[model samples]
Target: MARLDIKRKRVALTRELARLKHDLQARELDLEIQCRAMQDTLGELEESRSRYAELYDYAPVGYLTFDAKGCITEINLTGAAVLGMERTRLIGMPMSVFIDKGSCQLFFTHLRSCRLTGKKVTTEVKLAPKNAAPIHAQIISMPLPGGKGYGSQYRSIIADITERRHMEQEMLRMDRLNLIGEMAAGIAHEIRNPMTTVRGFLQTFMRRQEFAHIQSQLDLMLTELDRANAIITEYLSLARNKPVDQSLQSLNKIVADLLPLMESDALLHAKWVVAELPDSLPELRLDAQEIRQLLLNLVRNGLEAMAPGGRITLRTAVEDNQVVLFIQDQGPGIPAEVLPKLGTPFVTTKEDGTGLGLPICYSIAQRHHAQIEIETGNCGTTFIVKFPYPK
Candidate 1:
């Protein structure tokens, strides 16, 4: 009996020991699975962090953080690049440092509005970086929550919009050109016919002795009619229906032929005309008469704007795949108010000017699928006409 009882106790102990071992093994397996899961989660987090860093540093739009005082607190790599500065150097600097002098007020206004409204504010401003061209940037700023005892902060995104603005201006210019062309086509003949009849009768009356007392008046009438006729001629030039006769010709040779005529007019105004024609230039398809008209108008316009001893430079060069003709003048630059309305009909800066010359130039360029760009400053003005190479 004692032996049997001892055997039962041993069996029970062995069973208990086996149960304990199973529980330990199960717990170890669970721990191993959990460790692997933790490692996978850590790897995912690391990868996500790296991706975020790259995105922030290399974003297309510049990102900047500012304090309540409008000082830059942080700048991403893209933002630094846009400002043409190192990221480490930009931090803690005033954001206004990079804004153009003329646009500083605009930036402050945007900053104040964002902070006061605690909302997003957007504005277009020109940012002038050191030794770089002014950049047109669309700035979007939003207020950020401040920590305890801290003032409000801001986060801003800046996108370069210079090209977009240029495109928009080009579209507007084309629209204006189309409108002018339509108006010209509708009015050219209607206005010319009446002027012709009036001028013919005035000429007939001036020749008779019965109307000799008012002969001066008839002459005046004739002069005014001639002026009116000149205006109508310019209007006709803007008509899109006018056919263009394009022939492949040397631009340099044409310019050379026109120089004597231009210089003759320049001599009258005491202005010096200089030709910077290259020895050789690519031949382009051009309307000889129209190009002559265009050059005459531009050169005369430049000559009229200058005082005695001023210089007018006529230059031609190849840039990219286009031929560029530049007419530069040494005169007071075009007025700010007048520059924007340059090609509009009846807009002129001169008192006795008919305001049709530039519009005619623009019309000619439009017919040729060319582009006209003007650059003016306090020093002078340069008119650049670019013609595309034949495809």
Candidate 2:
């Protein structure tokens, strides 16, 4: 009995030792899993911080962080450059100091409204340079929702919009073309009928044998007569005082149909053409042929403006219930001084060019109840044709 009692105690001790070892292993595994989770969370937080840092440090536009009292707290390099001061110098300064004198109240009102209602305000703001003329900017004020416990941070974004303002001025100049088309209506119609009568009489007289030597002269007269008729026809189209033959036509299809002709001309001039058109465009009521012709004139002018090996970009989009086509070109854009003469009849760059092209485009827009806007600069020129959707 003593021997049996010793064996049983030994077995019980062995089993207890194994149970303790298993418990220790399980505790170590739990600790390792928790440590791994913490590491992963720390990595994610670091990545998020890096992204925010990049956005704050290198933003392309002016970025300014301010308090409700209009005190600048932080600003990006772009913002500092715009304010004509160093980043450190601007941190504690009043933001109003940077505002153009005439626009201080406007900036103040926008800042107040954004902070109070958490809304955004954007518009043109002029800022005087330290040693130069004033610069125009498009300012956007946004309320940066405060941190979990902090509620006093708001920021504003500003971009140099001097180029855009210049574009608007260009569009205003092109608007004059609309008036020239209005003047050509009667002259176009009256001259067309007389041209046809003159052509018929000249053709009959030129076929006579008695006038052999003068036949060549008659031929020259006939050629000039034809040229005159063509001019009248073009003018009539320009004075598009007619109604639209509305039909459901796809814009993409229209572009496709004209592609071959458009490409041929562009290729002959050694121009690079890019068409950013979709497989389909929304069908709308339009006089398709007229619109095509309008596009042709604009594209042709673009091709002519540049020498060999130039670039043209064509794109279309839908905005504000209107079909807008953008035709752009890389060329020395229209000079601001001479841009105003674009659509006046007989005003042209080429020796034999008639300035009626743009005016005709304007008349086409009027007939379709559309609007055309032209924007040009050293980089390029873009013509936007806005076709409205009938409600």
Candidate 3:
């Protein structure tokens, strides 16, 4: 009986040991699965962080962070490029350094407004980046809460609005052109008829024996009437009913043919004329007569503006798929007040000028589907006519 009892105890002990071993193995398998899941979560987090970094750096608009002192704390790639500087070098630099002198007050006011109200503020300003032309920028800034004993900060988004501003200016110019066209059509016929009748009477009087003594005075009067008639003709040219006869023509050849006439006029004014024509230029669809008139008017204007010994440069080139003609004069530049009013009817700087010359040129350019851009400063003035390439 004692042997049988010991056998039963041994069997029970073995069964308990087997159950404990199975429980330990199950716990180890669960831990391994949990470890794999943790690894996957870590991998996903890393990928998400990388994607966020790329989005922050490669955004289209410029993004910048400014400290309480208005110095740059953080800048993205686009922001650095807009300022024409390297990100590393721009760090800690004052934001005002990139702002144009004329727009400093505007930027400061915007920043102050944002900080004081703890709200978003926006402004348009000119930014003069290094090694780049001044650009019109629309800046939207929001106040950022500070942390770790720091003061309020600013986050700004900057967008380049130069093209938008140009479009606005162009629209205004077209409005002026339309108004001039309407005025020209209304009065051109009335003025030409009276001028022509007076010119005919003056000629008839000059041929008579009784008017022989005053023939010179009569001749002057006739000349004045002819001048008036010429002005009316130019004014009439602005009529849209007169269609342009366009043909594929070489601009270089046209310029070459006009060189002699331009030089003669320049010499009469005691100024030198230079033509810079490229050896090869693309042909353009244009009205040859109108283009000739445009060149004559622009060159004559340039020559007239200069003093003796001043030089006028007429150049033709291809730029950005367009044909360009530029007339530059070494004058004291256009007056500030007159600059904005250029190409308007009867807006002239010369005492004897009827102010119709530039307006006529503008009319011709518009008919040819071209644009005229003027640049003037203390040094001189340049008129650039850009014609689109034939489709």
Query: lDDT: which candidate is best?
Result: 1
Model 2 misses residue 282 by how many Å? 1.7
* Candidate 3 residue lDDT tens string, 22-68: 98889898899999999999999999988987898889889999988
TM-score preference between candidates 2 and 3, better one = 3
Which 10-residue window in model 1 sums to the lowest lDDT?
Answer: 144-153
Query: TM-score for every candidate vs. truth?
Result: 0.74, 0.53, 0.74
> What are the per-residue Cα lDDT tens digits for candidate 1 across 190-223?
8889888988898889889999999998998899
| Tens digits of lDDT, candidate 2, 1-391 | 9989999999999999899899889989999999999999999999999988778767889888888778899898888887788889888888777679998888778777776777787867788756556778877888877663232767778888877876676456445544444455657667767887888888888777777779878889988888877766676675445546878888777877887888888998889777888765678778898989888999999998987899788888888878888999988899887676665567788777877788778777777778888899997899998988765
Model 2 / residue 18 / CA error / Å: 87
TM for candidate 2 is 0.53
Candidates in descending lDDT order: 1, 3, 2
lDDT of 2: 0.79
Clashing pairs in 2: none
Positional deviation of residue 363's Cα in model 1 after best superposition, in angstroms: 2.7
10 residues in a row with least lDDT, candidate 2: 173-182
